[model samples]
Target: MNITRFFIQGNEACARGAIKAGCKFFAGYPITPSTEVAEDAAIILPKEGGTFIQMEDEISALGAVIGAAWAGVKGMTATSGPGFSLMQEHIGYAAMTETPLVIVDVQRGSPSTAQPTMASQSDMMQARWGSHGDYEIIALVPSSVQECFDFTVEAFNLAEKYRVPVIVLSDEIIGHMREKINIPDKVEIIARKMPEEGPETFLPYKAEPDGVSPMPPFGAGYKIHVTGLTHDERGYPDASNPETHTKLVKRLCNKILNHRGELTRVKELYTEDADIIVVSYGAPSRSAITAVKNAREKGIKAGHIKLEIVWPFPEEIIRSAAQQASDIIVAEMNLGQMVYEVERVVKSDAEVSLLPKIGGQIHRPEEFLEMIYKCQK
Candidate 1:
């Protein structure tokens, strides 16, 4: 499909992507770095016969999204660091209940509200394991405004396709940056599969061969008992039998892990024959790519590994890169979120070092060059 070029801010592009993905419900509170997303939804959703609610808090915002998703509508919410922290519990709920929803986290700095208006990629690990519990989350990190638009739509599609909460993890830099994005006239969108059996035979948690249960909307004839606790195929709370618990947990994890081949996506730059690899994601990755190219000019064998899908870790690719590369430098906004994952996969085989920074500042290209020099030495 041909896409038309248009200059747009990352947040605005995300909203447009969600609208294109058939999102009909948005409930979120206003937060810096992410407020533009809510604002755009407020203005555009109504025009598309969609509903937008300015919730009182991030908790309520996520709650409303879950409710709307259960009602058979594509639902989403956008927030920054503090708000993202508040919504973790509900994120867990959405995972346990197999609820399909999209969360736009325009991340800012810190363990708290460190920087409201500034950017930070510190939320990379948080997006993966912020919520309490063992569950799989699909997170997409877009580097440019165009990907911000394209990935938001893809986020919604993955959410509905997997019946799990998907997060569009952006940072303040990308969220507010204005760039030209080619918005497609007509793009492919995926919707959830409704129950096929009669109400009497329907089991909300009953797994298919692929382990994904057919979703039934709230008002649908097939009544669903959604809860955060471990449940049986019938959707009723079932904590007694270890067999049931094992099956339920396995299904939840396998539904995503088994499909890793499809879920894991990434971008590689000049990886072939590169002795040193700079691993990064989100906006920081943009700088890493430049660093790799600049290092190459100076006779350094440096390449870049840019993560598009953060969750599931892309272990296969990381492992391959680790085995082939002499050194791996992880550059991220946080002190060591994704660095740990790289270490785990790469280990002593690859000399792994973290070029860490926080508090609204990103890792500079010069820092990456330093790492490349160290790797060469």
Candidate 2:
């Protein structure tokens, strides 16, 4: 078997992963930390028989991606905090329409672009509830360059499978970092399920028991109605009907939430007999995991839970860890976003504390160790 290896930036790996996952359309606006994802997509996509377009802004970039998805091609876009904020409306649009596309947000210090070239995980909550209406979306966080590739592939697969927008929640640190990663020649590719019936008999939003409808491409002779308003199974706008709105919205959220067991992905170490657990995601996990390892070396019963899939937030994992551990330390590059979810889930089962690092820096290993020691005390 021929093996390929390359030492590349996380952004470049993400582009390559999208290409591998059958992403044939990329529409994006350049922003710091995430610009290289579009840069590499521009360089690699054409060679792979794909199209790359730089839209006027983040809104149109995602608009183009949503357009491409309806046209039967896998689509993707990448951006940072401000751009991500711009794409929120379209994110909701994609959810209401059940359009399958991948969005990569290489987060930076924010509010209003506080730090462009620095790292942050402050976008965690935004990724979950950024849009106006209620909907569920899948988000994957990659700690290493290898996961940058792997999770991008997974993001596309999940998007196509669930017929929802999937976000790659990368930060500046992982987006710009360089490392060697193995490129497997063949990766499992999952395409959207097409309708079995003819176009005349199709109901575009009619779903199976799993709450996911079969998506038919635009040119596939299917006359489909796609809209952002409350839509029925026929995809027609029924904005005034309360029942239609409730059913549509619930399915939009539950299509992902109901499959929580399948969507939640985390990496655990030393959790079996741990007294303290450090929970983290994105770039902060890199430090949190190391600290847990060092704590173990010092005879501390510390464990680590690295969140690979950030949303539909992994409640069960934290709850189980809380049951086994006396204290849980939540490490993140923000002022306590996901820690709140951890606290909510753990809720008196275990003492939950936040170990936050903001303003463009990540938590150091020693900081996590100190927190673990403090928790122990």
Candidate 3:
């Protein structure tokens, strides 16, 4: 076993993970809290036979990654809230064109340039619906430095599998925090499936039974017509036809949504008989688990749910937890974002509550205990 271990920051781990996942092209602009990801990529990618370019802005950074993917290389980019905001339009373009790319957003306090060095999970909603139009997105939230690496690699695998962009949602705390992690010499990698047919017979946008089309890299002798407009199976614009647009859009969304069972990844602690459930992801999950253990000691029957994959919004898990627990508490470093999704899924089956902490602070286990006590009363 050729496993190497190191003590590193979450952002560094993300860059290393991208390399391990066969990401050969990286395009990014430096931004606080996430600059290290790009810095690390620039240093390591070239050594690993990958190319790294710093773009003028986040929009161009993502645009470059999208272009790289079409050229048949696994690609990635990283940013903070402001840069992530700049990348939204390009994100929509990647979704529209079904480009396989990975984006790492190390979140900070926001609406605007509120706090750069601070930590916040306020961007959770933005990740899901930041861009205009409807398309399913795959997003993962890492709670620790280790997951920052693991999730980045998984992000690449999922992106290639579904032919869509994948987001790794990390907060400033998780991004800057240092921890020891083991990097395996060989991790499972999923390559892009290519068309078996020759260029003359290949239809770029035509999907198989799995709802994914085999992609041929540029210069693979396949005359590919890539477009952001309503595209047909031939990958050409079919703008005016309502049926073409509906069918094309639905398949794009369903490629990920319909495979929700495979996309959902979560961790359950003491949830089997829990009366109070703490639903959280990213940095907050660190405190949530501690609070849950403390509650259990006091005979509170408390449990914690750590979301590894956030988007496509794991409704089934929350729905089952709602059925088992009387009160579900969602703790996040936001005013109130993901809590709405919990409420929607839980409905009247259980009471949904939010424990929001903003202004660059994470919840302490004691704060969670107080919330649990209040839930009891």
Candidate ordering by lDDT (highest first): 3, 2, 1
Encode model 3's per-residue lDDT on 271-350: one tens digit a residue.
99998999999998988898999899989999999999989999999999999999999999999999999999999999
Per-residue lDDT tens digits of candidate 1, residues 1-377? 77788898999999999999999999999999999999999999999999999999999999999999888899999999899999999999999889999999998977787788888887887888898868898999999999999899999999988889999999999999999878988789886897788889888898888888779787776767888877888989887888988888888889999998998899998888888999888889888998999999998888899999988789999899988898998988878889999999887888998898787877788988987887788
For each candidate, what is the lDDT?
0.90, 0.93, 0.94
Best by lDDT: 3
RMSD list, candidates in order? 1.2, 0.8, 0.7
**Candidate 2: where is the Cα deviation over 4 Å?**
none
TM-scores for all candidates? 0.98, 0.99, 0.99
Candidate 3, superposed: residue stretches over 4 Å from native: none
Error of 1 at 145 (Å): 0.5
Residues 1-377 of candidate 2 have per-residue lDDT tens digits of: 45599999999999999999999999999899899999999999999999999999999999999999999999999999999999999999998899999999999998797999999998999999999978999999999999999999999999989999999999999999999999998788998889999988889888889999899988888978888888888988999999999998998889888999998899999999999999999888888888999999999999999999989999999999999999999998988899889988998999999998888988999999999999999
**Clash number for every model?**
0, 0, 0
Lowest summed lDDT over 10 consecutive residues: which window, candidate 3?
Answer: 217-226
